[model samples]
Target: MKAQLELLSKYSGTAIEEIEVLFKDNPRLQSASVLGVNIFEELKTQINKSQVLKELIVYINDNYSVGDKLAPEREVAEILGYERSTIREYYPNLKLFGYLDIQHGKSTLFKRSFEHQIIELVKL
Candidate 1:
């Protein structure tokens, strides 16, 4: 752990004292360290991007119909409490699954009913 901290300090330019303080402050980080896992990597893998996609599907199903125009990415991000980039990241997935039609310089449109796609998303 000392070696790991020293390497992290060397690469990140963060003092060992500051890194120790961060570990002391965040229980999750402390736990990850104790388990010999990289917390940053764990955090990246643990972000439920599919869950967010499922949520967007449900939101579209509940609020919009086929051919109906959807809000811009920024507005949808605000409504969903996610970064616009995150929402945009999943737009292609939605399009591939036949739920949405995303076009450059145009509002996204509901391409089809996503009620059935919810089950598919759960399997992902």
Candidate 2:
């Protein structure tokens, strides 16, 4: 976890202290389940309650100006202590909401426009 936080800190210019609010805030990110299996609903619950998950979203969103690239789901899962399959299951929602895009042979990209929507959602 320490190493992952360090990696996240490296990716984002803001230190952990500066971005603590992002982690502390009650961020509720959700979407309709594409698979119709309630997986997203389950994962959203976890993400909403987990500071590490919220930090991952915020760190990527906050660091987007530096570059939109994101660490893959597998790496993020390792950091957040979730299964890669769980991360993979939740990815469709992220993509559906435009928070992330997966490119072949390239790192995922975080979308700032969608991130703005997320910020607005959090404000509500």
Q: Best lDDT goes to which candidate?
A: 1
Model 1 misses residue 74 by how many Å? Answer: 0.6
Question: What lDDT tens digits, residue by residue, belong to model 2 across residues 67-96?
Answer: 467777788788668788866675665666
Q: What's the CA error at residue 28 for candidate 2, in Å? A: 30
RMSD of every prediction: 14.7, 16.1
Residue-pair clashes per candidate: 0, 0
Estimate, for each residue in 32-87, the C-alpha lDDT of model 1 and write its tens digit: 55443354333224335467866676667777889999988899889989999988
Clashes of 2: 0
